[model samples]
Target: MRFSSRVNAGAMNPIAAQAAAAKAAGHPLGQLNDSNPTHHGLAPQFLPEAYTADPRGPLGARQAIADFINASRGRGVDSANAPAAPAVDPSNLYVLSSTSEAYAWLAMLLCNPGEAILMPKPGYPLIESICNLTATRAIPYQQFFDGSWALDLASIENALREGNGSVKAIAVINPNNPTGAYTKLGERQRLVELAKRYDAAIIADEVFYDFTLEPFDGNARWAGEQGVLTFSLDGFSKMLAAPHAKVGWIEVSGPAEDVAQAERHLDMISDDFLPMSNLIADCIPAMLQEAATQTERVAARVRGNMAELHRLLDADKQSGDGVVDVLRSEGGWNVLLRFPSSIDENALGLRLAHDFHMNCQPGYYFDMQSNGFLSISLLPEPTQFERNVQIILEAVHRELA
Candidate 1:
């Protein structure tokens, strides 16, 4: 039995690295490290009504899921007689404990050892680890940022043309994590076309899809209608502010023919893990029924926190210490605040914890080489977020200046 080298010696997952380092120092981390909701207090939203609802209750989880599938948005689970859920069928949607677990199944289903996929750098830290954990390769592309993040399409084109064409998938974090910028609608179209041209598939991790700070709502994207295939990932973790529920899903949307093939493969993979815990998987239906009300409330809190953050940053943007530009996001609970590269982020992160008692994430964690990219969660109540932001801003100002 031989082990692959990439899996053994690539950059370690940053979240895990931070946890280990924290435990080593005897100061459990402040935990701005992982995107899990438990850190930010989203566990309250994740409580499954089914947990309290009786097994004999007519409208408990099992029925709620059935009704939600029959509803318009849950097109993924339409009928049991059908081989796969219609995009509208609730049953077609498969939830995972975390997007990381979703990544595991996806990697195993798509790649063989030694095969690769083009992932964007300065992006999600889990992207590569997921591949490595599953014994596959994550070759990276650049998500360029001078001020706002943008795709370096030329590099993508070159990689696609230059490679031996072994790559079978490409991932884009729409309204990317760490970056917090939406994939431009025009760019989204181009991505679909690119996947088709390369004979590859798209995996859009849109966990942050509902957290838009933008004025307008992004569209309900469906790749199945287009000639290309895509697996759009999202879950209660972000949608319902319920990370404690451990509900995440991979949506198969693409051209009918390709989707059929993709589904055949994905269903087998999902079934292998079969009977996703009855608890949260059971909550999906009730969650959907109450989505309209719950989503609005969550969105309001997130929107308020985002607005407050901007007000503080904007008021001091012209100060002598220099300005920090916060990335404007369309959908997601986080923002990327970029600062002077002169100051080290990891050092600053440590200082924020020890000196200011505030926790913030460094940019490098996301494979972002540029320093001063800090990630913060919007789950904190308005007052807590406001206080923490000031601590970070003041620290960066004092340390860097």
Candidate 2:
């Protein structure tokens, strides 16, 4: 894969290289120039007395994460219902502050100025902003919906062809936001082939992988993929249902040579940023201990709310010939509600917020192809969620009438 000039230009300074070698050799050297308060024993008792900087984050934290991920994926071996995937190696992981930071680092690692990364349209809206901030071109590839969403492989090939070696990576949001469609195995295989042919890497965002609603059989996590240079992203934000927890990671796997080179450059980038703090890193194990229970708790909330949404909407359709329809959601915290095209989405959004006193995101916020689609969150309390769907159904009925 073609890495950016910025990453190529980065190399360890002689002093740092020697220090690293010395540390690896178990010959600890006193740092006379160390300025960190923790290193000088001036920090509070809660903080570590010594500041040990590990570019890939502290080892203990990474181990806890790896163990958690492996256990999560190892359940129900060879089963279509659960992860049933391979184990993760802690050495292959990079613990960062958030997935947003991971995207920026990957963009910097892959694309130079004017070079591109192909993103899914009707996808995560923040990706374009991240690309723009990193000076990388955000190229869009189509994901069409018939009854369920599927990638337009031809569009992806077209983008790669047009890029002509300028495209460095393809971003796959597994069980994509709003759409809630997991990338099928066939789609994954084709994507790997495309990445190989185009000399690009795959950035798989599996943040929402655990909350399966109506997913197909044999759905799996992308973390252990070995076909191409793949970086699978997941974090506490979604896993533990705690957005305040500032912990996310990238699990790098693929061909041996590609993986090594990517990790070396990523290590350099991580060392420069030192994104994860020791205090937060220390809390990871405890947080991960809560992960399983928390995920199940949040899963129940989203799944129950989704059922409520369907119940209310289905009943309304039976009675009033409702125009609003809930799209088939396989996974994720959000679902798409389709209304008649005659009712403008912007006006509906206004009516819901202004008159009905309820807030919901218009589908265009996620770059939906047409009007009259609203992105509804499935995370609300059951009663409140039912009421919100009721208001939406009434508003759409009035609009259709």
Candidate 3:
């Protein structure tokens, strides 16, 4: 039995292997790498009416999504300081199971076998698997971090130029995972220009759009951008803290001809799978209307945990032997901590699990370029999170001593 090389090339990386080993050890693991809100006790309540709804989903749900995007992105408001983001049309929205499925559909729509897609380095690692599944190639462009993460436009342009026009699409995660840097307006403009120049589509994953911790000046919605075909992906996974609900969407916008052609292809792709559960689709309007309540709970938890982390780290620094430096994160559910150069991240992670009974992810899991970085979840229960942080700090201090 012969399998395709793409399938053969795709396997779980070492980080996942270590995580599994830790789980199998049956110790009381304080998980600091969790992202699932439900696991942290933030599940949403669904309406009973959802159970008997149409399989294609209700129009009301799509309209609710449009309204949520418009209001959140500061569109249709009278404020002078607000970005002039156009209102999203419900007709352009298509429901899906999750962002993972959305990526797969987009990959199928944009690329043929062996065609390339540009992704960001030090970003989410799942895109490679998505591309591999669709028989597409995932090429990464660098994002350099000084005080904050910045787009390396020269690197992106070089990637496109070097691809010889085989690059089908570029993926941008607004308020990117781990790094938590929002794509600025200038960066978005440059990206659209690059896409137009290379004749490729743009895939904007704004799943963490609602979790901004500071006042940001740029627009979050990409649904109404002109001149280039753009697919803006988001879902209930992050917005309502309802990952178990498995609801997501893609909003298509561009020149009329391009959008129409893309929609025709996407419709066929979506129809074949019909992945969105009817119940979740029907519950979307209520879920979205009540989203603030759930998101506020999550936001408060994340903020509380982050504050505790900072306070603890500050105390450690005051002790004059602190070995961890918390990286600046503008938004998102995870925070990055850079440890001393002497510590091996993988070894530290293993030791934390086996000796300290704390489960945390090493930075290599997120494609960090160095060995001393660790990514810890900000979504764990507050008390558990505090305990985990103290354990982590003690371990680091011991190592430094």
Candidate 4:
């Protein structure tokens, strides 16, 4: 029995698996961990009434993708700075089954065995798993936490520099999972510059673009005109509130030359996999057209729940008890909660599930070592969320005080 050195074999982490086990026990362990929209009861009818349409074929696929591109371009994006349409042609708009699979294509395109791709710490773990499974290295970059997470450019630059240019790409989750901070326009431009200077690509996973609570009217314009190769990853996942829809996309944009080369390669790869899901592709335009209203509804819910969570934490803080402090949440469904270093978030998390019967995510899973972090799904039903959050906050008060 033998295996390639790159074979991480997709082993499940015991902590998460145990949590899943507790959840599967068919009772209330106050689930605060997962961010699955369907699990939280997001209704599919909120999407445009056309989700049931099926893609006709290759031409049908092209038309479905074209509609999204045309609509996105017609959204009054500054055409001078942005492409205002999908680049490398509409056929270049390769549809995929999920963002996880998109990462696989991207990882193969960007990194070779043992080569590195920069990822955020206190970030999503899937990138690490993908890199490990594919034999590429997932290098950690610090997302500085001081009330809010900021992209540490100096550290990112150092990581690329220190790697002797082995870093092929850098991943940014616009509304990063676990931590909901969106990269600022200024930061986005800076990263593009760094990517070109380092000769690397910036893979922007923007699945949560529409769920923003505040206005980021012009952020998408940052995609091009930066002289860097940028791939914008997005799809029906969040747009339709239909995670079961199984549709995600990667749009290649940036420098004229790099865009061409990236397109040729991406198209070839897409051809090889033929990964497009006909059902999901047919549903894109309808989802886009109909999602605007639901977007507002979800954003409001996120803000209301997050505000309530913060109010409780603030009350604890005023009492000189450091229960938790939410970092500035700009956009996205989850917020980061920092607790005292002595609190073993994992152990406390298990205790909360077993003893207090509440659910939450430990900070360590996202790579926080010293500071204890807790993550809650912002998409939970309000009435139930308030009850669960009360229990979570009480548990935090007990653990940290």
Candidate achieving the largest lDDT: 2
- What residue pairs clash in candidate 3, if any at all? none
TM per prediction: 0.75, 0.94, 0.83, 0.77
Highest-TM-score candidate: 2
Worst 10 residues of 1 by lDDT: 50-59
Model 4: residues >4 Å from true position, as ranges?
1-59, 69-89, 213-226, 277-280, 315-322
**Tens digit of per-residue lDDT, candidate 2, span 52-119:** 67789988899999888777667225655544555778899999999999999999998899899999
lDDT (tens digit, per residue) of candidate 1 on 1-401 = 11123222235499868886888799876744566454455556555232321211222443454455346455554445532334443434555566778777777666767767788887877889888877778888888765567787777767776666667677888767767767776677777777677777777787766566763444444423345677767666666667676766666666667666565566556556653655555556767766667677888888898889888888777565546767766566777777888878887888898898776678777878657688887768888898888888888877865
Model 4 residue pairs with clashes: 30-359, 147-327
Query: lDDT values of the candidates?
Result: 0.67, 0.87, 0.79, 0.70
Cα lDDT of model 3 by residue, 167-227, tens digit: 9898998878888888888898899999989888999898887776552665455757766
* Overall local distance difference test of candidate 1: 0.67
Cα RMSD of all models vs. native, in order, equals: 14.5, 2.3, 14.5, 14.6
- Comparing 2 with 3 on TM-score, the higher-scoring candidate is 2
Summarize candidate 4's per-residue lDDT along 88-150 as a digit string, tens digits.
355445567888888887887777688888998878899999999878899998887675667
Q: Model 3 lDDT vs. the true structure?
A: 0.79
Question: Which segments of candidate 1 are over 4 A away from where they belong?
Answer: 1-87, 90-92, 215-225, 277-280, 317-322
| Winner by lDDT between candidate 4 and candidate 1 | 4
